[model samples]
Every structure is written in C-alpha cells, then in structure tokens.
Target: MGFTTRPELRGTFGAVSSTHWLASAVGMSILEKGHTAFDAAVAAGFVLQVVEPHLNGPGGEVPIIVTPAGADEPIVISGQGPSPAKATIAYFRKLGLDIIPGTGLLPACVPGAFGAWLTLLRDHGSAELEEVLAPAIHYAENGHPLVPRIANTIATMRELFTTHWPSSADVYLPNGEAPEAGKLFRNPQIAALYGRILEEAKTAPSREARINAALDFWYRGPVAERIEEFCATESVWDVSGRHHKGLLTADDMAAFKPEIEKPVSVAYGEYQVFKCGAWSQGPVLLQMLQLLADTEIARLDPLSPDFVHLAVESAKLAMADREAWYGDSPEVPLGTLLSSSYAAERRALIGETASMEVRPGSPDGRRPILPPLMEVGTIPQPGLGGGEPTVARDRQLPNDSQGEPSLNKEGAQRGDTCQVSAVDRWGNMVSATPSGGWLQSSPVIPGLGFSLTTRGQMFWLEEGLNSSLKPRVRPRTTLTPSTVHRGGVPYLAFGTPGGDQQDQWQLLMLLRHIHGGMNLQEAIDAPAFHTDHLPSSFWPREISFGSVTLEARFPGETVEELRRRGHVVTVGDPWSEGRLSAVAREMDRGSQIIKAGANPRGMQGYAVAR
Candidate 1:
C-alpha cells in the first residue's frame, strides 16, 4: 500500500478521535483545559450526538470500555437500554409480525445514552455536569456545519417527515425543505430542554449531586413525560408494512439505569483484550482470537490470500456462535464458549474451502438452538429489514419517500454510528461506540427533538433462545467498543462503527499490529477485508456464503488466488472501507506520550493531538 496521507497524531498531554472533526476538537479542548479523560469523552460523545444526528442521537445507546489509571481490569459500562415492559414476542406476533420492525416506535427502547454518560462523568470526572454538556448545547442551540450525507438523508426522507412524521419535519425539515449541506443546522428545542435541565442542576450544591439530578430529570421528570405522552399518542409508518404506536412508557424509562460491570478479557501472549459481556458482540473478538490461536498466521504475509482466508473462516464460525449463543440474558454459555479447548474443537472446522452452512457450537455440553437457516446466496440489501443504514459503502444511502431513489446515487456512500476514543496524560483511557436512534429510525418525539433506538430489531421473536424478544430484557446489541491493557497498564483504545462489520474491521487492524509489527495508524490504514458468510445481525438477517470483500489495493494474483480457494471475491476501492480510529500510549522521555489516528475514508472521521 502507498503511504498514508493522514499520519499518526502524537501529543504529550492527550489524544482524541471521533466521527466528526468538531467533536474531536471539542474533546481535545476539554482535555487541554485540565479536565479528566472521562470528561473529554463525555463532552465528545454529546457533541457527536449534535453533529452526527444521522448516525446517532441522545435517544441512542452507547457501550463503553474504560480503564482508569492503576486499575488492573477494564470495566464495561452498558449504555445500552432495555426493551419496554410491553415489548413482548406475543405483542409483536399479535401485530401479525414474526419479528419486530427494524425502524419505528414499536421497537423503541428507553433512551440510555444520557443517563449512561452522566453516570460515568459524575463518578469519575472532576468537571461539573454543565461544563461537560455545554459544547453540545452550544452546537444544538446555535448551529454546526451539516455533513453532506446527513443533508442528503434529510432530503430523501423529507416527504416521509412532512407527511407521516410532521413532528420530525418541524425539527429536521425547517420551513418544509431539507437543510443544505455545510449550512448551519440548529435544533433549538433540544437545546431548550437541555438548558432547562442545566438550570435545574444549578439548585444542587455539589457537582455530583447536580449530575445525578440531571439523570433523574431525563428519566423520570419532564423529559420522560414528554416522551411517554408522544409515543403513547403518535404512530408512524416504518419498515413495517404499517404504522404502529410505541411500546415504551415513562415507567420503563424511570426504571432504567446504566450498569458498570467487569469486562470479559482474553489473553494473546503479552497483550490482554477486554470487551463487554454477552450483552454485546464485543466478546466476538475474544472468540475470534481464541479460534486463531493455533494458526501459524505469523508465517503468512499480512496481505496474502492465506491470511485473508484464515480471518474470514474464523469470523464465520465466531459470528455464527454470536447468533446462537450471545444475548443480554445469562442463558448463554459464554464462559465455556471462550475456553481454549472449545476453540480447539471449533477451529478444526476451518477447512480448505469455504462452507455455506451456519453452525454454532453446543457449549457446556448442551445443544444450542440456532436461528432459522438463511440460504447462503441470499445477499442482504440495505434497509432490507428497514434497519438504519450501516458503515458499509457497498450499500445505498437513504432512498426518497416517493420510492424514487436518488438519481445521483452513483458513488458508494460511506457509513454510520458515532465513536469516541480518548486517553489523557493521567493514564485514563476510554473507547465508546454510540449508535442506534438515527433520524430514519423512528418518528421524533414532538418536544424531545430525538427518536428512540430500534435496537430491539436485533432480537429474534422465536421461542427458547438466548436473544428471544422479551419485555424489559436488554437486546443483544451490536454496539461494541474495546480497550486493551498490558500488565495492568492501559495501552490502547480503538473501535469502529460498522454494525456487524465493526469487530471484523477491528480484528484485521489488530492482527496487523501484533503480527506485522506495525504501529497504530499503519495497522488501521492497511487494506481491510471481511466476509458475508454469516447471517447479518441487522434486519432481514440475510446471508451470502464464501463472499469476501477486499480492498482493490491487494495484489491481483492474491485476489484471484482467494477466488481459486472456493471464495467469492469482490473488489472495493482502496481506502474505501473501514471507518476505524484508534489511540495508544507509550513511555517517552521518562513520561507517557499519546498517539491517535482516525480513518480518512469519506473525510468524516477525525483525529488530533498536541
């Protein structure tokens, strides 16, 4: 590959990477202002909600992996919310559906991002809640440059907004027209709501107390009241064949709270990788690592056909297990599944040729019930399940309301979700993926200025499975962020925002870093590849066997060699895939220096230091 135009950003005090440059700047400014890493991360997260509304919102969820200074083990903070009390398989089946709609009110969960971020800030941060939130408020009340894709999404969905979701139309399509790209876009209603919350916080004597009060207001007070009232009354057309009311209520919102728990860790030689529990797909990385443990991957070229085949084959087995054995509930045998011995058995399945069969392991000596077998050739289409679009460039962006798609949709559009990675001089490090609740996900609540996450779309309506849809249960979410530590010291924070492809992209970067001896940006900028052999986690759950997508930068002989190995190969433009970003720390001059890098694809992700 040619030299990367975006070099690794190195600094002494801190480093930050996020989906938007403005968000990254705001975060670094917080760190430069003497705030803690936790404070910077929360500030950047809130800014991302304001600047990347097409990707994420306050109504969305975030899963965070955090490693504070001197801590031996990283912790997983679940910003992911649960389904409402009324979100039951029976209810969805009663609506004449076998699965929940991928977009709209019926799949709505309690908004968890605000409470989750506040919980982190109040507990670990020295900054006041108002200070952390001020940047988002400013951008929301005033304006920020609208990214081109968000402008295009608004234009395509304008009629749907104006006719079916007028409350949303009032907020997004001002005066009945899409906001032009690069124009200052403002959502003052959201600003006013947050302004009121901050004013209420002023009555509290302590900073921690003020942050707690804001959380209460968001979950049980006026904000929740407005959400409850709106969802109870309004119905909107979605990917479902018909319109439907929401299942979420104020009581559900009030009952919800983010949890801080231990992360599941996997060891690979000197490095220790940490990820969230079965509640997320984070552990998929661990499972993948274990499966590849015995492979002589180091002997193969990083861009060789052999290395690509091993990665894709391992991903197929691990992702199939994700479908059958992973979920928020404890019914999953995640412990046994992650064992090296179990991996030995599963790893043996990596044959010379690609297999179309979807197979999950029966860990703990019990049979695992798998989801319906999708035919391998059934390639997933964008928005097939009426899902929010993902980071994959191969898929089309938002289509217009009249069913007349964009005539200008010639080029492949880049991706989704908001991600922030921050590490400060004090040894504080965090990796977070905030997603769901896109503008197209649901009708906006009239006064709240955001929509509820449709994460429930990830759960199956089938009976007797780990991820079966149930009232008040957290859905198995795809939003995963990762942190790595070496010998009790935080070392790396890295993540991407692709849906099912998130872990896939991260794994490629990781192997290149460890096995190829490349630094952070070198690993990230290397050409990446992924397989569609397993069923997609998004709606429609489609499958495509032996289908591998590779950056065209790879040698032509290597590409053809993969096809000769019984793989179906497709070529993507160089640097066109993987919106991944990363931050790392190392000792320099008797002190630690921070380094960060963001993806250059689509010109959206930004990284900065010094």
Candidate 2:
C-alpha cells in the first residue's frame, strides 16, 4: 500500500526474479520458449555466471530448492562441492598455516556449478542442452556490459593479477588495464570452453545422454584434466603472503556428483517453510522462526525497535547454533535443533537488553562444542587478494582491526553471492543461491576463463568439530536459499546474496509479510538490518559481540532506542543492506497466478512476469 521501489508483478503465466536484470530477462525468455521453471532457472543461472563474474562463476557452487508442479514436497539440489582428499587439517598444519587462505589455489574445491546445472537440466527440465547454454555462451563470446561493482572489483585486484596471477591478468586485465564500468566486457575463453563441451555433448544420441556427456566432459574428461594439470604444476600467490600449489585433482572432480535430497521443513502457522539441509546455513532461518513462534511477533510493528530487537536476538541464538552444530557431517543433530521445545529453551535467553555473549544451546542434552575463536588482531590482512567481494563500508577501521579483507583503507567490501528464483504457470518453482569462485577469490585457470572456488576457507583448522578441515568433506557454506508452502502447497521461492546476512534479511522480509501484512515489494523495500554477533562463516572468522547494522532509512528515534537496548548500532547508507529476490505462485478463483518482487538496492535486481 505504501510507496514501493516497483510494483509486485502479477500475472497468469510465468515469473522470474534474479540478482541481475540480464539474467532475469534470460529466464523470461526461456519461459517464453515454453520451457519449465527448471529450464528457465538453469538458463538464467548460467547467464549469471557470465554477467556477475565478480559474484559467481562456473567454478563456484550453488544450492537450489525446487518443487515440481503437483509434487508433495520440495527437494534440495546440493551443488556444494566437497574438499579434495588431500585437504586435511594435518596437511594445513604441516604447511605452518592455522587457517586456509581466502584466495589462491590451495583452497580450491571441485567446481560443482557446471555439473549441478547439467543435473537440473537432465532430470527436471524440458529444454535441450544447447538451448539452456546458448544465452550464456552468446554473452561470453560477444560481450555484456560490466556493472560498476565488477569494474571496481577488477580495479581493486589489478595489482595482484598483473604481478602474480598472469593467467587472471590475461583474462581480466584486457589491454593491461581494468575494464571501465558500463563498458562491454567479454571472456571468449569461457565461450570457447562451453562450445567445445556442447560439441562433445552432440556426440551423444539422446537429450539425457547429451547432458550426461557434458557432465563427463566437465568432471572426468578434459576440463578436470586441465584443472588437475594446472594445480599440480602451478604455484600461485594467495592471502597467506606466499605461493602454494592446490590440492584438488582430476580424481576429486570425478568422485563428486551433486545430490538431490529432501528439504528440512518447519511449520509456522499456516505456512511450511523449507530449506536445504545443514550443509548450508538454511536451517538457521527455520530455527529463527521457531525461536520467535512463542512471542507476540504478529502484533508488533515491523519497523519498531521492539521488532528489530526481537528479530536480531533470535538470529543471534540461531546463528550460534549454526556455528556449533551445522555442517556436512552426520553428527549434526538438526532434528532436535529445530524442535519446538529446544526453541523454547533458547527463547528464554532474551531479556529487556541485548546479550553480548555467543551462546549455543544444548540439543537432546548434548553439550555443545564450538571451534576455537580467533582473537582480535590475530587474523592476517594481506591486502585486496583476500576477502569476499562486497561494498565498502563508510566507516574506517585500522588494518589490524579488520576481520574480512578490504580493498582500501576505508573499510571491508565483501560481496559473496548471487540468487535466482523462478515459477512457471503450472506451479513449478525454484530458488537458488549461487556463490564462490569470485574473480577476487582465486586466480583464473589458464584457458578456462574462470577461477576455482576458495570455499575451503570456511573450514576451521581445529580437529573433532563439525566444521573442521577434513579430506573430501564439505565446508559448511553460508550460501542458502528458501521456499515456502502454504497449506502444504508450494507458494513461494526466495533468497538473497549476503554471506551471513542472507537468512537475517530473509527473516525480516518473511516476518513482515506473514505478520505485518505487507506485500513482497513492501517487505523487500522496508529498512533492513542484521546482527554480526556470531562468528562469520567466511575467512578470518571474526565475531562482533552485540553489533547491529541497519539501513539509514530506519527512523532516528528507532536507532536511539536500539542503542538504549544495548545493541551496538551502526547505520549504513539507505538501500545498502539487502539484494533479495522472490517469485511465487497461487490460485485465484481456480485460476493459476504468478507473482514476483526484487530488491531495488544496487539497481541490478529485476523481476519479470507475463
């Protein structure tokens, strides 16, 4: 009802929303071609790897939540690749390193994005492999306009590329300089690589066989051979201030395959929210909902300090549980953690004032154990080569005090992920968060035109813990996507791009929509906030006790009120917080309808419907 950045799109056909306008258009185009939502999402996902190279690439990973039309429940496509067999805690300790470097070859994992997309296309989609990949190849071969952030990220990493990673320099630093913003940029090497794969796939006799052939080319054939050769021979500079060879191998790639599993769901009133398993931070959102279920969340004004305090406090508890228990291993007691009784025990910790301590609750009488915390001033800052790609904060901190890597003296600019959501006329829906292998995260592989993912940096060096560095195990990732079913029918698919802030922002939007009666655009457009009270999932793993960052659009009185409640509040520029996008489907008078919304921040996200 109030002013929105744009209208919440509504139609009787299909809807698509993504972090990039070009990707959204690509998804819309696939829908126009009469393909399924799975096809549209696969096409748009590949396009994002080309257009938003600073955020994601073919070498990264993605976690997708999908519900086919008339399906009983949503399924999670676990695209997160595991660590190499050689990436053990002993191996890192032998190298005299206490933590994995945030950049370079040493932290490289088996790139899973390509295989994951192929799997989605092979199993659920109705489009051909060539059709699904044409948009991405066209953009990569010809050119696409560079967003300002991509240009800025390249400019920031220019010295590192030119001086150390020449393969990266050859691809990114065209004409020995960073490409200007809004200018056309191309990566013909990636285009040629996909073209070769398509050609190889064409040798197959059937559509499914073609997709499987492409998968083999990427994981067991030439692509894996190239990556293995490079890692075995080349030593590259990284955030450790030293050159190191990677541990990944052709066997690691060959051994890995994306798995489709059931999603974890929790009931909230009439809605059943679903998220990926504990391998991701998705369940934290479910935990937050459980923590708030007993409170007066529906009666409180979403913009008031009361609502903000409750939300942030609940996030702190849930995120603490995430740090203590969530991982890729079977030891994660996710069921008890999401139990209503456990939520009640955790909810009892909230008071009239904020709590500064990091607290993890006991599940089923099990004593919680956490990874060793990194003390302040202990994390190394080896310049722009480290850290995720994000916006630079306005405030300045001393070099020794920085947690994540910063591009300049101003502050840390960490852009970690990208998101896409699609819903077709038949009610098929998909939500995916694709991230890692950022241009700044690692050196580009020669001739591949894309970099390896440094997701291994999320693992701690300590032994015996769930997130400890281990051979052939997944590092608990921060990339999470969400979906919801109203009255046991798939109704919504949504997600965002912030590393730790993904679930936090989504919590606010969901609370506002379900309780405050706000539409999708209104929920997204509302002032966003998040707590940094838990240890970060990224490199250098810093924790800021009682810290809360809010958009300046929040009222001044509310800011003061939060400070009064003992929250260490930092107000950021208006529209600087979230990049969430969502698409939904429902029936109106027995006629199917599609609805969509996208974040207005960064002027990049778009929603299309018809």
Model 2 spans with C-alpha error above 4 angstroms = 375-413
Residue-wise C-alpha lDDT for candidate 2, range 210-286, written one tens digit per residue: 99999999999999999999999999877667789999999999999998899998999999999999988899999
Model 1 agreement with the true structure over 362-447: per-residue lDDT tens digits: 89778878877665335344342333222222322211110011112333332267789999989889999998778866777777
Instruction: Score residue 133 of candidate 1 by CA lDDT.
Output: 84
lDDT of 2 at 118: 83
> What CA root-mean-square deviation does each model show from the true structure?
3.7, 2.8
On a 0 to 100 scale, what is the lDDT of residue 197 in model 1? Answer: 94
The candidate maximizing TM-score is 2
Clashing residue pairs in candidate 1 are 391-415
Q: lDDT of each structure?
A: 0.81, 0.87
